[model samples]
Target: MAGTSLAGWLLLAIYLPTIHGLRLAQMGTMSPNGGDDGVDFRPAYHITPPSNWMNDPNGLMERDGIFHVFFQFNPSAPIWGAPHWGHVASRDLAHWQRLPVALSPEETYDIDGVFSGSATVLPDGDPVIMYTGTSRRQELGFFWQVQALARPENGSDPLLQRWVKDPRNPVIEDAPPRGTNFQFRDPQTAWRQEVGEELGSLWLTTIGSQVSCVGAAPMYASRDFVKWEFFGYLHSQPGVVPSENETECTFGETQFGAEGRNWEVVCYFPKRVGEEVIHIFKYSDQIRGRTPFGRDWYVLSDVPLAFTNKTVPGQGNALTPSLRGAPFAPAIIDHGDIYASKFFNTSSGRLLWMGWSFETSTGCTGTCSDGTPLTDARGWQGLQTIPREVQVDLETGQLLMTPIGEVEALRSAQLFEQGGMKLVPGARRALPLKFPKGGSGGRQMDVSATFKLSDEASAEVSSTGFKVGVAVTHGRTGALTSVFLNGSLSAGGGGVEELEMWVDRSATGGATSANLQGGRVTLGGVAKEVTLRLLVDRSVVEAVGQGGRVRATSRVYPAGRGDWGLELFNEGAAGSVVAGVEAWEMEGAFVDDLW
Candidate 1:
């Protein structure tokens, strides 16, 4: 789909608003399929997509003050096909401003893909989009799905530029009964159902289903947002992981419901405050595996369809599996490589999120890992995991996820600081907080630490207590990437002793692209102070324990250069670990005019 030559559409409407209001223009991170240079691992502020393939995080929305995001692109090549909606904006989600591809597949009911949906700002402020439109109905070769709508051809350029697609096309054509529009699609992000009295002012949504095989979401209402009305499956797949005696087994009662593992792209998140309201669902790709990894599950429900009064004898009100006990127990909120997306709303109700970090589809079949060759430069895959703010700890419901204090305004200084430091038993330690400000070595960082296990690491767990770790190396081809706090190997079986995380990049050879990327996380008992938080850019590290239950994202590619930075090991043979650490120096959210 690459044929725009009217002088490239009039220099793209004056270079897309002067490159979205260029805030200084050094324009970092620019590979877009060119000769590579590494540039210390890209991601200056995260939310990439100036080049090719992007997954989920579609139609996100915000208004007047501006914030749209929209994604799932593939504009002419990078990888996946069909996709289209890919826009960007920001009044200050930290200087982002890209906009151009907002919805494509250019017609005939979305010629092929315009997947993942959600985005709204109505109430009279104008801004509405609800997507999921495919189209390959050769009399039904299976791929028809509907639900479409778009707007903003002129809210007067809130940076919205041009949209407008509601020819009534497939505003909800069908697909839910036999369930094939490739398993329904993503929808969530349309709320407003409390003007009471018989669903007045209705406008609720929640697509993403699977019917007979479990995993569901199907529930719609709409009033003027383009006719809809499903009202059926509201929370199935209740078996919410339990098994070893704890009961709870619904993916149609096990074997992961005949190997489909269900669940995909489902979001719900209600969240309200000042009047208190919460709900929460969020989902995406679960089990049925040989490497099924891409989790983001959640449960805590009280609204948006969670165990909704059952009735699925022959699939009437759907949500089957004979619901009865264990009403809520999903939990997983993040195992990193987040997906789909959620946690939207705001105006004073603070809490923002945006996911989709996928890109581990190794059908690579020939040279990668810097040797190049997999074509379109691996089609510029995924990115966009650093837009958090998410809150809801109202007493440990845990989802605190912080990364948005405008990312500490992108740091810039504070280089290093320590406070307490201990490391008995076979010791080892390294340090070099942020370097590469101007002398140029690249690696951007923003670390924060606090690990304490002493008391001989909770009174001995045999040896290996002091393996407290942190390494992002290259000190001459030791080409590293480590993260360990071996609580007897990240909290193995014990009586109240959790909090575990161990990541080993096999010396920079780990994270085979799509990331099944390991880095265990136990976070259960063992607590004497455990707070690790890292964000190291230069091949993305991520890692956030203690504040977000437990996380550990991945992506590494060392390649070796000079001594490189960061190090602090602390092996053990005696036991005792205590740390304090703190680092800084980030700055670089790309395109300051393409440095």
Candidate 2:
């Protein structure tokens, strides 16, 4: 997916001198509320490129108390083509500083593009980046992908602004026997363990691919970081037929791929919860109804497996027995516009996840109807989701994902706070609020609320369930996006109550409104209040429900723009209560002149 046309790369090279360093390096420092071009949809607090296209957080690691983020970028244009490794650094996670381009497609093996990969620290404490290099194979006259390695030009540089590709390029030159050549990319960070007495401290990594129409992450082992050998699979699963037909079916046709093929960006790691240690395997796929487009998927290996470093008697290594033969019952991680997520553990023991939030539509090329330049026309295309802290439930083995607490630093003085507000069925009421001077016109907000049924028995007895909603609206055009919570009895013969959070953007009128997505969790029939926390940044809206047990994120473009208004409504036959509501204006994260 990272490879672009040769013409695109050639065109980009002509402007490489300006795009690489001269322009970005000129920006001195980033302030919380400075350096924006008045593009309304550009996120204030999210991580975005200073200009041009950006996607997929790659080689994420913290070194020398500084966090380094390398991502897929196209400095030449605001579209996906001719990628280079764009660099950024941060001491506090909330604020960011731009750096020069880290890696480019200048070599023979990677002329097409420098794609996604992972970063790990060596035994000597120097960090190395393992990435996939895409190039056109002369013999076959087609593009091919191979695994490669790179290191910082000067390891002592805390920001890691410059990188040098290893002369031993294409460390793993060819895909394994059963793996498809082009489908293999995005190498996972290798883990080290002592294998047999003869093979000591082998490094193992997984490459995502499809074999026999089934998805797999084939593991490869290297004694050093250069020489490699084939190992078995970390996880494999066949795709299932989708149940919904909201869009044109493409997965089974030539346009997509074969029926049950799920392969992209393999991530596997272990975490200890209480007295037990469990493994998590994650991948990205474009299944029709499950993820419906591209989204992150995960499978929790619930069974107990020895995660110790000591060698196992029957299994050649401890990691092999723990990772191999793991079952593939996968679940969607986020129900909205997030995909290609990368995870890193901090020195403080916080496991963080970051993902690419791609544009939902083809995007406007020149100007919008109102004569303002669109996001693409302004020279930037994508932004990253806020970093999330992820943890597993000990009893249920479900994932709990929440926005990291560091983001709270961006919140301004509270703009609106209310409690004990009630609304009758089919009624809507506005919540009046004042905005900060020179604010983002309600484009940035941190809102938290709790909704509960005024009559719980009526909702349980009814078949359709009860719904309570909060609407963010443009007062002039009357366009709005609604976040609703619906509660109902379970349909699976259990008397459990099911609580669902759904976002409706049909009135927002943008490329992102096409998908009406929702996620639900079981609440044991006697559950009481449903809590929601929403983080909004212009086009992006992320909702965390039931204390991060369920989450959905989507993009919305309102027809007309001004300061936003908030309204509370009850859509079900029963009444509902807004126990508490709080909202705050958010400050910008980066101030750069490149925009």
**Highest-scoring model, lDDT:** 2
Worst 10 contiguous positions by lDDT, candidate 1: 365-374
Tens digit of lDDT per residue, candidate 2, span 251-367? 233113435564678788777877666677788876544434576887776455332332111122222322234433566788888778888877787888888887664333211
> What lDDT would each prediction earn against the true structure?
0.60, 0.69
| Candidate number of the best TM-score | 2
Assess every candidate by TM-score.
Answer: 0.36, 0.83
User: Taking the tens digit of each residue's C-alpha lDDT, what string does model 1 give over 1-595?
Assistant: 4222322442353234233223213433233322122244445567766654667777676787777778886655556677777777777676676766767675766778778788778888888788888777776465566788888888877687678788776777675554545567777778766434555567777787665455667777778878886656655453454222222232232323433445667776666634556666666655443343446666654333332323331233322222123355555655545566666866766767767765442343211212223324333556777777776654444466677777777677777889678766666677755564473243667777776665444343443344566676754656677766554423332322433665566667422352334344545444556667778776667777665566666665555345356676667543456687887767766443211
In model 1, the number of clashes is 22
| Superposed Cα deviation of residue 61, candidate 1 (Å) | 21
> Worst 10-residue stretch by lDDT in candidate 2?
310-319
